[model samples]
Target: MHPDQSPLRARSAPRHVPPLLLDIDQMLDEFSRQAVRAEFRFDPDTPAVVTVEFLAERGPGVIWRIGRQLLHRGLTEMSGFSDVRMWPTLSGERPSSWLLLETQEMEALFELPTAELAEWLDATYRIIPDETELDGLDWDGFLLGLTGGPGVPGE
Candidate 1:
């Protein structure tokens, strides 16, 4: 019996698994391919309804819409992919917190409460092995100085 194929050994053995790092480019690709959808709240107080659609082909990389208005057009690529950061609050939290999406040029702040961010991530990205792999990363300091805190940009 091959050691690698041995059932007993496989059951008891633990393989050295590499940490799952967030690859923004790949994530965007998956996001486009899957046609993922999520709500972007520009204003937390008023609960502004903003729609985010990831596009694989056709027009700009993303479509931002509020009611019948189009805010941005022709976003070829997410500039400064390495600099985006996300900060999610504890599960089952009220009114939801925020997921800080920051870039060198601008930031997209969303009020994603509790499992909303997690659900969005699961829907948009192809997680390897399992979703739990994502828990290893530090979302609070995802991009360091680019962000202010977990809930919002300033607070």
Candidate 2:
């Protein structure tokens, strides 16, 4: 969410990473918590794909389309790796996505950063272990860890 060029303008289609595709819920959750704890960081190749549309004519429409995609698809896109994937938002909150790997994960991928995003992560993310651990910790990562996907960025 780098805003050096722009201000309050974040309207884009959310990245699509299927949730059921992986089951590393706990790890992802903690990861997100750490990120939120750290604040939202920006990167060139972030797991979460963001779209920013701030116009009057087609703004509402694009927002709807992108927002829906973000909420539905983006929400689950990072389900296993990026902490953002584990974000908490209303179920089926299409047009408004949730979950994304925390700043830590983003930084792991991209090093260049600003202090503002870090503060954002610190304010938003919070860890919750008791709730999601029962689901077996989303084994998608272990198998994928071998493949070199989100489970392992540069394997």
Candidate 3:
């Protein structure tokens, strides 16, 4: 091994946290109750819309979909959770058009219109059809953090 590339140096190197990242733990908790829908498009100029849905509690991880395209199968160990990256554009600090969902073996990137689209991904248990529904959810499954807020970036 090169002397300059010491094992200690490599271990000490910091991972690059993006300028904005929606909390991953929050997202996981949010999905545990119900499926949330989001929209994305491959191209900016074109008007094609793809609907993405988030599902949870299947196993150790979550699931995602784009329209009728079922991303993965049922009861599978492999799952990918999404990270909403907030990009600083000329307009302001808004959620980036792209999202990265990754797992051990693979990663999928998606394009959405704006950062606001990530509002549905919050872990607050914000979407309750009725107050009674809350009684059945597993509140203990959440591993929340102090960062990130629903519908806002870098909160």
Candidate 4:
């Protein structure tokens, strides 16, 4: 779907792409495997970040904030480092991407449909193009917030 035609874009609100159902790679534990549902949320107000929420049967679940550009780059090639990493896999019958999320306690791997993710990223770009990401930022307010009020010591 064209980004402009998206209902969320029309309303100028955060866009929540439909839940992407993925299967947790059984390689983590040969005996235990299950489906994991995730939702991708993009806010035009915070154009640089994309929030990924892993849904659970109960409670708040898990949330990860990732750089928007990192994900876009991952769609075609391997991207990210440290705790998060993603890469496209053409070996499968259906083109998909492998996303790895690692923490001190454990690591999880998920296969995502490449085309669907690309489409959603396109929509986010349409809402707020990369070049204009800082256009709406409040620089003065941001500085004040960062410095705990008033002018910088040097100035």
Identify the candidate with maximal lDDT: 4
For candidate 1, the TM-score is: 0.26
- State TM-scores per candidate: 0.26, 0.17, 0.24, 0.72
lDDT of 3 at 134: 40
What is the per-residue lDDT of model 3 for residues 1-155, given as tens digits with 9 covering 90 to 100? 68889888776524221122222222334234222334222211111112344333453334333321112110122222343222222343543343456667765444333333333322111322223334554444332332333534345
Q: What lDDT would each prediction earn against the true structure?
A: 0.36, 0.30, 0.33, 0.78
| Residue 118 alpha-carbon offset, candidate 1, angstroms | 3.2
Off by over 4 Å in 1: 1-82, 89-95, 119-127, 131-155
Deviation in Å, model 1, residue 78 alpha carbon: 22
Instruction: Please write out the lDDT profile of model 1 over residues 1-155, one tens digit for every residue.
Output: 67568777656523322221221222333234222334343322212223444344455555443421111110111222233323433545353443335556765554333344334333322322232434556656766535655555456
Task: Write the number of the candidate with greater lDDT, choosing between 2 and 4.
Answer: 4
Query: C-alpha displacement of 43 in model 4, angstroms?
Result: 0.6
Stretches off by above 4 angstroms in model 3 are 1-96, 115-135, 138-155
In model 1, pairs of residues that clash are 96-113
Candidate 4's C-alpha runs over 4 A off are: 1-27, 30-33, 139-155
Tell me model 2's lDDT, rounded to 2 decimals: 0.30
